[model samples]
Target: MTLSLYNTMTRTTSEFKPLVEGKVGIYLCGATVQGAPHIGHIRSGVNFDILRRWLTHLGYDVTFIRNVTDIDDKILHKAVHENIPWWEVAMKYEKAFAWAYETLNVQSPTYEPRATGHITQMVELMQTLIDNGSAYAPGNGDVYLDVRALKSYLTLSNQKLDDLQSTGDSEDSFKKDPRDFALWKAAKPGDPSWPTPWGAGRPGWHLECSAMAHAYLGAEFDIHGGGLDLIFPHHENEIAQSESAGWGFAKVWMHNAWVTTSGEKMSKSLGNSLLVSEIVKKVRPIELRWYLGSAHYRSMVEFSFEALEENSINFRRIEGFLIRASEILQRTPDISISEKFAAAMNDDLAVPTALADISDLVREGNSAITAGDNQSLGTIAAQVRGALYILGCDPFDSVFASGAGSNSSAMDGLVSLALAQREAARARKDFAAADAIRDQILELGIIIEDTPAGPRWTLAR
Candidate 1:
């Protein structure tokens, strides 16, 4: 099946055709760097990481851009509250986010640009908008986008001009129209400022994405992605600003749904936000990634402790099958995923369906094992591993191998020694000794299974 994605702008599922053949450019709205990443923030990372992986699997050279808003009102506020420099606050949280992403095995983007580093590009973009009359800089170093000048100002948000509320980004006195949003903010006392054509101020939240995306992905890119909550003023303003400057902007606007708690958006203010660091303590990083990426990207995930535990158990089942199959085959073999799995992924990244296919394959693999069909077991295991690889959850993938809840090398050696003793006892026909050794291994949280190949052991889930 050909790749198709839901474009937020047109409100329909459309076939994906890249601007440049065999090369796909994606711009994802990354974290704001005000605090440590929560599941809500990292959901976007995991969702887009899956998309990037799938595209790479399809032989596309993907240039993925996920930006960081290192300078923002939230960062400044946190700095003041914590009695530290704003840049320090941004850097600290930025490192935390990077750590979380790496721990979860989310692949690094081709370019991860920070908003503060691209001030010159933003200034040039503002100057272009000002020259084109779509932007005006008040003498006070504040610049506002002329929303009325754009023909389809709220097309992306699907809202009328008068029906929209003020962005509250800047004081209303500086804006010519109440609906107009700030492209740049004038400097205030104690606030971090940069020299620009307008004045020594900073970039607005919306303007930074537009400027940085243009700087890296060029005038037009294949896909622009972020959380659904950004569809309104953030993405809407980007369309108005970039199009007014005669750039094609993003071809497809993809927005992932939020991770909610108690029917409300997961947020720190609500006291329901689950930090990635906090959750990883309960479950391994690979399990956490599976839980986050299990749902369809466009569907809302109501966060719950029960659901997380359940998902973790289900992932272990898949892992258990791979371990048993590897033991039977004596090695990890190459894989060819089912066609149904590929079709599901190509259909707007229907991950839930793709995962269902994986579950079916696991069932078949287990059945083959029970039937003592080693050949069938190896084939099914390869298919399951292949599918997991596409989803970034493969057990043997180096990323997961380093951090998963697997036994350490020393533990492996110790288990092997115990198994060798058990083997000697069985060879001597001493059933009592072999049973005692098996019981001891079970007490140590290892499950030893007698198979046609040999005695196989795995850490009990």
Candidate 2:
């Protein structure tokens, strides 16, 4: 099946035809660098990473761009609260976000541009808008995008210009129209400033992404992605300004659903305790990635410790089967993606259905193991690993070899010792003792199964 993605612009899932065939460019709005990353922030990263991986698997040359907002209002406020330079605050949290992404095994983008580094490009973009009369400076050094001058506006958000509210990005006194959004803010008394034709000021949040995306991906790109919360003012303003400047902007807009808690969008305030660093201590990074990427990209993930634990256990079951299969085959199984799995991934990135395919393979592979069918086990294990590789959670991948909860070799040895005790009880005709030993292992969430070869232990689902 050909790839079909849900385009937020068209409000339909249609076949994806890249502007340039076999070459795809994607711009994903990255971290704002105001604080450490939580599961909610990383969900966008993982979702887009899956899309990039699938595109690569299909032989598309993918150039992925994820930009960092290094200088923002929140970063400045954090700097003031921490009694440091705003740049220092941005660098600190930016490093924290980088570490979190690496820990989760998210692949590095082709280019990760910082908003502050591309001030020249932003100034140039603003100048184009100004020359086209799509923006104006109101003598206060603040440049505002003239929403009324745009030939097309609010197409992505599907909102009427008359119904739009004030952008609230700058002082209403500085804008000729209340609906006009700021392209550049006038320099403050003691804030970072860049020299532009209009004045010495910094770019707005929406302007940074538009400039960075245009700078790296040229006038237009294949896909633009971010969280659902960005669909309104952020993305809408981007379209209004970029198109007014004679650029096509993004061809397809993909917005992932939020990771919610108690039916509220997960924010740093509500997700402070759920930081990636804190969550990794409870579950392995690979397991966390599995849990985060399990749902469809457009589906909301309800945040809860109980749900996380259940998903981690399910991942371990797959991991255990792969480990046992490797031992039986005496070598790592080669990756072999199944047709059903590929089809599921192709259909709008339906990760849940793709995962179900992997689960089915694992189940059949376990049954093959119990029946001593090495050939079938090898084929099924290969397919399972292939499917997992696309999801960025392949057990054999070196990225997950030595992180938290990766002591699988030691776990196997300990389970083997317990199985030894159970075998001894059964050998001595002590059925009661054997049953008790099995019960103890089950309490630890490990299911011990006696087969023709020996006792196999897997994490209970």
Candidate 3:
């Protein structure tokens, strides 16, 4: 069956046809790099990573572009608050975001262009809009998209132009309409500025994405993705600025739902945000990725410590089955994603359904183990591993085994030595010593399970 995806633009699930057959170009609105990344911020990364993986699995040469807005109002505010240069703030948080993405095993994009790095592109785009009468630069060095000039200004957002509130990006006195969003902001005292035809100023949040997308992906791209919250001013403004300059912009729009907490959107202001760094310390990073990516892309995930722990346990069950099956087979099975799992993935990335299919296979593998059916175990293990590989959760994959499972090789070596000691104590009928060793291991947040084959060790939630 052909892959189908929900296009936020069409408001329907449609067959995915790339602009260039066998090649998919995807532009994802990436981090602004104002501060450390929260799980909410990384959700888009994981969701799109799965989409890119699935496309590649189907033989598409995916050129994924996830841009970083390294210069923005938030970065400047953070710099002033911390008494440092704005670039310092951007670099600090950019490194944090990079670490978070790596920890979650989100594959690196084909190109990660920084907004600050593409000021020339942004200027050229603005000049095109100005030449076409779709934008105007005030004497103040601030340029604004002429919302009234574009009949399709609100097409992506599906809202009447007048009904939208002012972008509040600039003073009302300088705007043709209060809703006209800024394409460029005039240089402010002590703010990071770039030289442009209009003046020395910085690129607006929305303009950066359009310019970066065009610079890398060209006039039109296959898929544009981000959090659903960007539907309004951010994405809407992108549509206006790009289309007004005669570019087709993104052909398909895909949005992942937010990660919320306590029935409210998760944000730094809520005081309920969970940073990726903090959560990785709680559960293995692979387990965290499973928990985040298990939900359907378009569905909101309610962030809860309890739910995260439960999901981690469920993932361990699957991982445990794979480990046991590998031992029995005497080799790691190659992933051959099952038809059912592929069908679900093809149908707009129904990850929840795909994961359920994985669970069913695990159950079948367990039953085969109980019945001593080696043939069935081998087959089931391969299917399970294939499905996990598509989801980027395969335990045997070196990516997760090396990075997510443990902190360092030295720590792993220490744990291995301790596990061996515990096993030796058990072999010698030293029940008290074994129990004490187990307790010590548990205190270190490591789980040791005794099975017929051997004692298995994993990080505990």
Candidate 4:
């Protein structure tokens, strides 16, 4: 089936056609990395990761580029607070982000360029704009894009020109127009500085993606995505600068909605934002990822302990099936993945529906287990795994090795030890000890539930 995506630029769901016949180039806006990432950070990554995985599965040579805005006002502020250099701050969090992404199983992009690393590309792009009259250096040694010179400046957003704030004009001391945003900022005291024909300064927030995307993915690309919060001013300015400067920019634009907390927006002020590391300690990393990948990409998802709790429960249900099937089916049969699952995913990455499909397969697999039909269960399990590759859900893993409850245990030993402890805890009327052992089991990404047949545990893939 041909994939279809909802283009934010055209505001329509159209069948995806790669600019190059068999290759797809995608540039997704990555986290600024000024602080530890939150659950909200993974939604866009998870959605686009699925897009890349599905396209690759369908025989497309996908080149994915996710840029890191390592040089930003926030990074500078953080550096000053810690009494460290700005580069140190950026590097610290960049490593943290990579660890979190690995934990969530989001695929690494083909090119993950840092804004500071691509200064030359940014300078060249800005020079092209100035030479073409779409941008200018207005005597302050800083560069700004001229909004008035570009006919399609605000076309992507369709926001009225009068509605934009004339407020951000520190560069060139008030660019040609109030809405004309900065392309480069002249260096100030105690901030990171770089050499450029525009003088000693740094790249602006919007300039990095335009430069990096052009540098890595060519003039035009297949898909561009980020959080919905960036559609305005950020991506809109990208469209203005790239199109005005003659790079074709992107054909399809996609944005995932924000994650709300307790019926309010998740923000620093509320002090309710759950960092990825903190939540990883509470539940399995896969559970945290499942919550992010559980909903429709375009829908505004709420974040709460209750929601995560519910997600944790649902993830355990699916983990239960994968575990039981692994034990009951010693000789698995060759399986063909279902096309209906593919169709659901191809439709704008309709993940909620895809998740429902996975649930359906789990129910069928469970029934097969009851009837001792290993062949049917193995076939369905294979299909479920193919679907989960798109979801970044690791349903069953053979090497839940390192982060398991303990370090020094053979596969047979870990399973046997856990079961023996469970029986011992149950006989001693030691419910607290029993619960502690259960948590120990979960830390290994293995879930145990007491059943009428007997106490059973499943490895969370």
- Residue 238's lDDT within candidate 1 is 92
Give one digit per residue, the lDDT tens place, for model 1 in 1-461. Answer: 78999999999998999999999999999999998999989999999999999999888999999999999888899999999999999999999999999988899999999999999999999999999899998788899999888877888888888886656665588778878888999999999899987789999999999999999999999999999989987999999999998999999999999999889998888887799999999888888899999899999999998999999999999988887788667787566778989999999999999998999999998999889888989888888888888777888877777433357889989988999999999999999999999999999888998877688777665
Per-model lDDT: 0.90, 0.90, 0.89, 0.81
Clashes (N, CA, C under 3 Å) per candidate: 0, 0, 1, 4
Among these predictions, the greatest TM-score belongs to: 1
In angstroms, the error of model 4 at 126 is: 1.3
**Residue ranges of candidate 4 with Cα displaced over 4 Å:** 165-172, 331-336, 398-461
Task: Judging by lDDT, tell me the better candidate of 2 and 4.
Answer: 2
The pairs that clash in candidate 2 are: none
Candidates in descending TM-score order: 1, 2, 3, 4
TM-score against native, each model: 0.94, 0.91, 0.91, 0.88
Query: Which structure is stronger by TM-score: 1 or 3?
Result: 1
Q: What is the total number of backbone clashes in candidate 1?
A: 0
Worst 10 residues of 2 by lDDT: 398-407
By summed lDDT, the worst window of 10 consecutive residues in model 4 runs over 398-407
lDDT by residue (tens digit), candidate 3, 1-461: 99999999889999999999899999999998998999999999999999999999999999999999999888888899999988899999999999999988899999999998898898999999999899999778999988888867677788887776655664468888787778999998877788988899888999999999999999998999999989987898898888888899998999999999998999887778789999988888888999899999899999899999999889989988987787777788767878999999999999888888898999999999888899999989999988888777878777776533445788778888998999999999999999999999999888888877678776754
1 against 2, candidate with superior TM-score: 1
The C-alpha local distance difference test score for the whole of candidate 2 amounts to 0.90
